[model samples]
Target: MLQHQDHLALRLALIANKRATVVRLRDERRIDDTVLRRLQATLDSEEVRLSGGAAVE
Candidate 1:
């Protein structure tokens, strides 16, 4: 449905934003292992959501 697509799009956008933040932090040498792990966990969860074909919201 259109609403589901919109939700997917929003989730994708959020993932992109988080990825960019991670990149920015890495570039600035401000990302610690704990932060990296957290981000990785979040990305993994998002990946699962996408793979499961579930709506984000």
Candidate 2:
């Protein structure tokens, strides 16, 4: 069972990481459509997990 504040913190971290990845992808000129799509998917899933938006892990 995760606390709400802790969960929010986790979510923030996930967002920060995703942002970093996006920056890296952009900087490396590797931000292809497929890669962006996959990153979006992963970010969405992580948000769900952080929000208790999914079934128990």
Candidate 3:
């Protein structure tokens, strides 16, 4: 049973945040590889938690 929806909401929020960050960085005419990697790592980590340690993709 999926009791709490926090994880799902957090995942959505992270996606929105990543989108915003990408747009901002793009408009600034510079992409920070470190920042992008960090965001991706955070997303992947959260997804792993959601999937109960199952492989993502």
Candidate closer to the true structure by lDDT (higher is better), 1 or 3: 1
Each candidate structure's TM-score, on Cα atoms with residue i matched to residue i, is 0.66, 0.55, 0.51
**What lDDT score is found at residue 33 in candidate 3?**
66
Off by over 4 Å in 3: 1-30
Give the distance in Å from residue 56's predicted Cα in candidate 3 to where it truly belongs.
0.9
Write the residue-wise lDDT of candidate 2 on 6-54 in tens digits: 8798776878788678868967888876787788777777777676776
Candidate 1 vs 3: which has more TM-score? 1
- Residue-wise lDDT of candidate 1 within 1-57, one digit each (tens)? 999989877887878788788978977889976787789688868866775865444
Q: Which model scores highest in TM-score?
A: 1
Candidate 3 residue-wise lDDT, 2-33, digit = tens: 54577676676777687678758856868776
Query: What is residue 36's positional error in candidate 3, in angstroms?
Result: 0.3
Total colliding residue pairs, candidate 1: 0
